[model samples]
Target: MISINNLTFNIGARALYDEANWHIKPGEKIGLIGANGTGKTTLLRLIVGDYTPSSGSISKAKDLKIGYLNQDLLSYQSDKSIVRVAMEAFARQNQLHTEIEEILEKLETEYSDELITRLTDRQQEFEQLDGYNIEYRAHEILAGLGFSEEDQKRQLNTFSGGWRMRVMLAKILLQQPDILLLDEPTNHLDLPSIKWLETYLGNFEGAVVIVSHDRWFLDRVIKKTVESRKGKLTPYAGNYTFYLEEKGIRETIQRGEFKNQQAKIKQEERLIERFRAKASKAKMAQSRIKMLEKMDRVDDVDDDNPEVNFSFRFTKQSGRHVVNIEHLNKSYPGVPILHQADGIIEKGDKIALIGANGRGKSTLLKIIAGTETFDGKVEAGHNVTMTFFSQHQLEALTLENTILEELQSFAPTYSETNLRSLLGSFLFTGDDVFKKIKVLSGGEKSRVALAKALTADANFLILDEPTNHLDIQSVNILIQALQQYEGTFIIVSHDRYFLDNIANRIWFIEEQKIKDYPGTYQEYEVWNSKRVIPKPAPIPVKQEEKAKKEEPRPVMQNAAQQLKKLNDELSRTEREVETLEKQVKEIETELADEQVYSEPARLTAANKRYQEAKAALDLAQQRWEELAAGIMEIEEK
Candidate 1:
């Protein structure tokens, strides 16, 4: 357990935290949230003792172990295999194993009772630590985090920064520390890995403090929400959604109180002004002034949520079809990414290209943008002015140019006022727009790139991981802008909440082919979950049916009896399928309820039931289809 009391931290003259107090209890899953530059990450560092506070103290229980995962770990390199790196978490067990091996080697040469006793003690301690299966546990965690068996055996230094970060995550998870401090942990994770982490953290026993922009993950994992604003930490009893609702209510009450206080102050000031001119009321007026001076003034609530009010206007409308891919065959030397894949992006289509990592989402995006090479045809429709945004574009920004200048240079035809307004929506306001691009942080550069992309006024947009460095507020701004824009866009992102809100269709690559799910992300999830049943293969001809063709057909009475038996079986399967279908629907309905989604235990239980029911329903439906075909064949005979 950790208790932060009167935590005052400052960076030079800027105070990041002022008397902000928070108590992280055991087994509590806390979501630390706020806008960018609000000190959420800084608070975590203060708790971890990575940064010293200006005053006050961060106290922890004696000998408490903490695991902290951050972007900095991306730079970590090791020559050891990933599994070995993760297994390093079991320090004592590994040491004991080595000592036991040494003893065994010595016993091979010479026997000693003392050595035997030491070996026995070491083995017992190793068993107590579960050291024998440490490697297996490491492999299991690595696989869950998206590493294949071969990948687990590869040297950690060979993997990219993202994959290395995953290895670091695996190591931390294997440690099982008393508390977990994760900052933007989902940034490097794909949808599947993120979900796996969600399940892992749900069952984690220690306290967890997560600072993530991933709303969906927070909603599913966090039990409490803490907001860092104006150098203060405010706690909410529930998760992110509850935090939003509760914050809104609190702000409304604060506004009302502020309004009433202003009214009272005005009434008293007017009375003081009128009475000051009279000799009899002069003393009374002075007393009233003293009372007004002593009264505590209520501060007005700040608007943390900024909405996009700027309109995106394009000069020309795009053709009915935005993009058309024909026989898209793309692959590397050994890996088959896509072969004979095809998809169409139409006008007004908001598509979310999503899947696990290394599934060719980014490659497909580049293909559509006409940037990457391929052995297929990708045609853009008539009058399709396009703009593509990616992480690489951030580096393309002119370092000397100011944020406002960057947008202006990109959109020379647009008015400066319009460009500034767009930048403001991206959280670069007034003087902030005057800052040089080189001085901005990665997140700020991302915002500038996004703003410039929007100013292009293109009818077709291709964006890859646009929300990578953005905070929750910045993401909301982009979502609002997209919601207002009438352009067709295909985006690849791991942020499910953003995709669910903006995308009308889902595209995923599977089996070396492009696939489309013509529905929202939520609907696609439900359909995809039950889509486990593979297409039925050609029904094998039964021996009786094969003999029947050469021999004669069965007698009329026998055929009738067989048909009745099939009909009875069909009816029973139909009833079972109906019941299972109803059960799935009921579980889905429960999942849709906010109350259930807000509770991690309830959500996990409901999802488990839903999966079970869906599997049953698929089996029953498959059986029914087989029976129906048999019935139809008999009738034809």
Candidate 2:
């Protein structure tokens, strides 16, 4: 329950918002999306009262509690344990608890009736607020966000910046505010933690407003989409998928209307020019001129943002087996991350290596990339040139070198124009190429690293969380570029949507073993969901028959029980198949629409969805068939 009426905010000469009216209702989940520097975060700050609007007002219920998680971690007590820091979320409850304890100590020393009454009142208030469970709740949130029990007792300063951000997130979640405002909450989280957050938010009773670049997370968590663009807020009534569909329709219609107006204006101007001097048509020509002057020109839709367009160029082709690992084992000190891991990477395989944090997904990638040593046989095939990109690779850049010089060092044969053009593709244009690496932000350094990797004529690319610092548009660009490349690559990423688009195979690492699934991430998920948990060893046939005879079959389904269970499963599988088929049809219809074909991103996304849905539908049908056969077998029995 927050409302903004005619909200206007400005930063220097730019109007971030002008007369913007938006209402966030109770229990609503909204996603804020836009290009980089489009004031998404600024709007969040304004709503949270950190920044005053230039004009208009933001209103909220007087009792509404807002928890805002900013991109930057807040200053915290370095010496305090993470659990203690998180417990501070319920400061009032903790204070009451402390006061109640003090009152009890006073009662032991012949306290007055007033002290007893105060203690009783404080205890009632604490119970009313569920304050007694505050410590348990804090630990639960910390564990869900990936802090081990030992980590909870560790000082906050011992954690890295990313983990510190996670601690802040845990604190916010523990507060359980009426409205949660998160900006890039998933930026620092691994896949497992992100999924945990998704489940937590799915069950949260309060309203949520998040700004994120993780499309899959947004699609799963948010019910509404709000775009901040050109000093206005546009709302979509559905999730990110529906938002994309509706946005495509609106842009297509807008472009058509603008084109029609331009055509009519051109025709009117031509007629006026031809009839200007005619005695009989002078009045008509003058009237047309006045009409032209009064007509508001239709501005062209602004959709032509510069897109990144470079592809990986290979100097030579690699053998069929690009990388082969056997009995790989790696450990650090007392921790063993991977053991007896074996896998093969073909020359043209695009593999997505995924797992929970500290489970050795990145370690496996490093081992395969030959950047790390291990106790296993890790071999590369003939002519397999590798280029690796990691956060550490960004740190390895020479801080004294300019962006242009960095690329030049990587490829000394490239001309200045070639270097500048390549840098421009990654959003470093003109004088930006001359900026020293020392002054670059993390995102800038990431882009430079990506650009360098792309320019290298490597046949096999090993990238770890390549899209961590990229915006949605840049990520799409990279996806498109990678889709067209003929090189083999192993990518470690938590972005499910990105993996869906690029990964042809899934290497899921669990319990120190690599399980290879020959499908996309979505397919892998469906398969994983359908995996049969090992059942306890069956009792002897005589015992089972004796128990069955002794147990009365009270008026129940009886003989049809097994059949009924199979029928229910069959029905569910059939329904899933139907839903996926429907999605495929809808995406196909959109792809067929002439308007959507004009936007490459929309077309690409639609096509990708169509393929994925078709694949899922096929899997569902197979599952349905299996269930039907099982039911028939049970009926015969």
Candidate with maximal lDDT = 1
- Tell me how far candidate 2 lies from the true structure as C-alpha RMSD in angstroms: 18.3
Candidate 1: global Cα-lDDT?
0.85
Badly placed stretches (over 4 Å) of model 2 are 74-77, 279-283, 304-308, 400-405, 412-425, 429-434, 532-637
Tens-place lDDT per residue, model 1, 98-121, is: 887677666656666687578669
Candidate 1 residue pairs in clash (backbone atoms < 3 Å) = none
lDDT for each candidate structure: 0.85, 0.81
lDDT of 2 at 34: 86
Task: After the best TM-score superposition of candidate 1, give how far the Cα of residue 282 lies from its true spot, in angstroms.
Answer: 1.0
TM-score of each: 0.83, 0.80
